[model samples]
Target: MIGVLVTFTQNEKFDRSTLAGIASELRGPFEGMAGLRFKSFMLDEDGVQARNFYVWDDEEKGRSFFTKELVDKVTGVYGVPPTIEYLDIVGFVDNSGT
Candidate 1:
């Protein structure tokens, strides 16, 4: 698996409620997204940043998803550019099922 960390930092603070709403609206589309194992939307209101974490089945799909277009699109949404980091998934734990 490949782990991806996408961080969006804004000069202005973001509303927690608004971020939650966005996450709620976006959940359905990502629930069964291909090549995506898991995804999380995280917010740091005090820090004025939102971090999105993703786990992909492979590096190719993960890297391919973060194209220039994606960055531009998200910059428009978040009002700032993002920093993307990809890392080898050394270990993972899922306790959803016994």
Candidate 2:
């Protein structure tokens, strides 16, 4: 499986309402995409940063969604650049269902 870990800082003016709107717009389409297993996102208000954890069936599937257009749109919203990292994981723990 492939994993994507993206970390970025939000603009000082970034608001929760705007973040919620963006998340709402992306949730459905992303979840429905082929080979997309799951996604988890979190924001650190004090640190003014955000992180996204995504699991995909393969590299192709992950790359298919992280296209330039999507990246541009997301960065535009944040008004800041992002640092993303891709990883290959050996295993994962699903504590939520337990």
* Maximum-TM-score candidate: 1
For model 2, give the 10-residue run with minimal summed lDDT. Answer: 10-19
lDDT of 2 by residue, 1-98 (tens): 88998777855635666666767777887767688888876677665776778999888888677888878876886667677789997988868787
**All candidates: TM-score:** 0.89, 0.78
> Model 1, poorest ten-residue lDDT window?
10-19
Angstrom error of the Cα, residue 87, model 2: value is 1.3
- Show the colliding residue pairs in model 1: none
lDDT of 1 by residue, 1-98 (tens): 99999998877888788778878887998888899999999997486989899999988999999999989987887778999999899999988687
Judged by whole-model lDDT over C-alpha atoms, candidate 1 comes out at 0.88
Off by over 4 Å in 1: none
Report lDDT (CA) for all predictions.
0.88, 0.76
Candidate closest to the true structure, highest lDDT: 1
